[model samples]
Target: MTLEILTADTLAPVRHGFFTRAGGASSGVFSGLNCGTGSSDQTEIVEINRARVADAMGVDASHLIGVHQIHSADAVHVTGPVTTKPKADGLVTRTPGLALSVLTADCQPVLLADAQSGVIGAAHAGWKGAQAGIVEATVDAMVALGAIRSQIHAVIGPTISQRAYEVGPEFFEEFMDEGPENARFFAGGDGDRMHFDLPGYGLSRLRAAGIASAEWTRHCTYFDPHRFFSYRRSVHEKAPDYGRLIATIVL
Candidate 1:
């Protein structure tokens, strides 16, 4: 099967994509391009998936860099390849040979670029990482790479949508504690449950960070199994593990 790489007009003229699970060698629970070595998926299979991504990006497999993605606000600035994936939720690079990438199943895979400044970034922004400020941190790191705050464009990739993201009151409280304005990102669900808008929250953060342009692909991972790999869906189905979708950006 051919790789079904998703792109946005907003990030056009820059080499970037939100890759789907259309082409890969892994099977069973990880049927498509499972780029996450952190999962229980086979190491060899994960390596093959990543190598395919690197080939699609026209770079060495090692140059398609990603982090350990600890769901923290932390961001890493990379100029070259590194053997170890550090513990960070975001990555930025001004160098031409390096491609910044992020892995996600249902969480937001955000790609950012300041084309005029020749800098690019990619982030894995789940609810925890967004609440902890991963999007803002990615913007800051891009700035350090000579990008202007007002010149960056961010696009949130496929993620679970609000209708499928039911959360308890405490989850709602965390956002409410941040600010009541955040309540807009939620809609009342069954009783104490509330549906949280992960992509909406990511857009709010990107816009708040003063990005020049911000948008979402509006692709819902949980709702599209044929084109996406969704963690929440896997859990609901009692799967042992799930494949990870890869999103990439290169300068």
Candidate 2:
């Protein structure tokens, strides 16, 4: 199968994609474009998958840079490929030849680009990273690279939606502890469980960062087994491991 790349018109002139698990070399649980080097998939296969993504972004495989994704409000500024990926959740680059990639199973993979400033960024935003302000941090980093936050366009890729993201009371408390206004992002679930709108929260954060425009692609990773890899779905099904989908943006 050919690689399935989801794009948005809002990010005009930026070579970006939300890659699905349609075309890759891996098999079993970690099948289809598992570009996550941290995954249990074969290292060689992961390299091949990442190379495919890099090619699609019109850059050398080595130019596709990623981070350790610690789910924190950290962003790295990249000028060139590194021998070792840094321990950060977001990456911003003013370099034209580089592509920033973010790996996620159910977490939001957000791509930001400012074609006028020749700056682009990618962020891994799980609940922790999003709540901790990773999205705002990425926008700020892009501005330091000469990208106007008002000129930046951010689009969130595939992720688990609220209807599929059942959470415990403790999970709700975590958000409440941060701020009580966050309660609007949740809905009633079974008993004390609540459904969190992760993608919605991601967009809210991006918009709050003063980005000109931001939106989610409406692709739910947990609900769609054929197109995505979902960590929560894997756990629910009792799978040993889950695959990761890669989203990339090149300047």
Candidate 3:
């Protein structure tokens, strides 16, 4: 099968993509394009998937860099291939031939770029990381790499949409405690449950960080099993594990 990679015009002229689970070697629960090294999917199979992503990005497999996503606001700047993945949720680089990538299965995979400055970034923005300010942290890291705050364009990749993201009262309260305005991101669900608009929240954070342009692909992971991998869906189905989709950007 051919790989399905999604791109945005806002990040045009720079190489980037939000890859779908179309072409891969894994089977069963992890059927397509499982690029996560941390997953229980066969290590060799995962490597093969990642290598495919690198090939699509026009970079060597070793240069397809990523961090050890701890769901924190931390971001790191890398000049070249990294031997050791840092414990961060975001990555930025100004180096040519290096692809910044992130793995996601429902959580937002955000690709950012300032093509004119030759800088690019990729972030794993789960709700926790986003609430902790991962978006701003990524922009700051890019700025450290000579990218202008007002020149960066960010695009949130496939993630679970509001209609599929039901949360408990505690989850709603957590965001409300952050700020009452956060209530706007949640809508009434069943009784005490609420639906959170993760992509909407991501766009808000990107704009608030002063990015020149920000948009979501508007692809809902949970709703599109054939094209996406959704952690929430996997859990609901009682699957033991789920494949992770990859998103990448290179300068």
Candidate 4:
């Protein structure tokens, strides 16, 4: 199978993609484009997967940049291929010839770019990172790299949707603790369980950060087994590990 890449028109003329688990060398649980080096998948296979993604973005394998992704609001600025991936959740680059990438299973893989300013960014935004302001931080990082927040267009790739993201009252309360208005992002689930609208929250944050435009592709990772890799879905299936989907953007 050929690689399946999802793109958004908002980030016009930028070579970017939210890669699906379609074409890759890995097999079994960590099958199909599992570019996550942090996974238990073989290092060689992961490199091959990442190299495929780098090629798709029109860059050499080493130019595809990633981070340690501590699920924080931190963003790293890059000028070239990083020898060691930094401990950050977001990456921004003003330099051309570099592709910013992030690995995700169910988290929001956000790609941001200012075509006019020649800057691009990629962020890993799980609920913790999102709530802690990863989206806003990414925009800020892009701005620091000469990208106008108003000129930056952000697109959130595949993520777990509300219907599949059941949460506990504690989780709901935590978001509510951030703000009562956050209650709007949740729907009643079974008993004290609530469904959180992660993508909606991501859009809200991106828009709130004064980006030119923001939107989610609306593809639910948990719901689509073939096209996506879902951490929650893996847990439910009692699988030992799950694959990660790679999203990348190049200047």
**Which has the greatest lDDT?**
3
| Alpha-carbon deviation at 52 in model 3, angstroms | 0.8
* TM-score of candidate 3 relative to the true fold: 0.99
lDDT of 4 by residue, 128-150 (tens): 99999998998998898889878
Q: What lDDT score goes with residue 136 in model 1?
A: 99
Task: Give the count of colliding residue pairs in each prediction.
Answer: 0, 0, 0, 0
Regions more than 4 Å wrong, model 1: none
Tens-digit lDDT string for candidate 1 (114-201): 9888989999999999999999999999998899999899999999999999999989888889999998999998899999999999
As a TM-score, model 4 comes out at 0.99
TM-score of each: 0.98, 0.98, 0.99, 0.99
| Shift of residue 236 alpha carbon in model 3, Å | 0.4
Model 2 Cα lDDT, one tens digit per residue, 61-104: 98998999899999999999999989999999988888899999
lDDT of 2 at 28: 96
Q: Which stretches of candidate 3 lie over 4 Å from their true place?
A: none
Pairs that collide, model 3: none
Off by over 4 Å in 4: none
lDDT over C-alpha atoms for residue 131 of model 3:
94
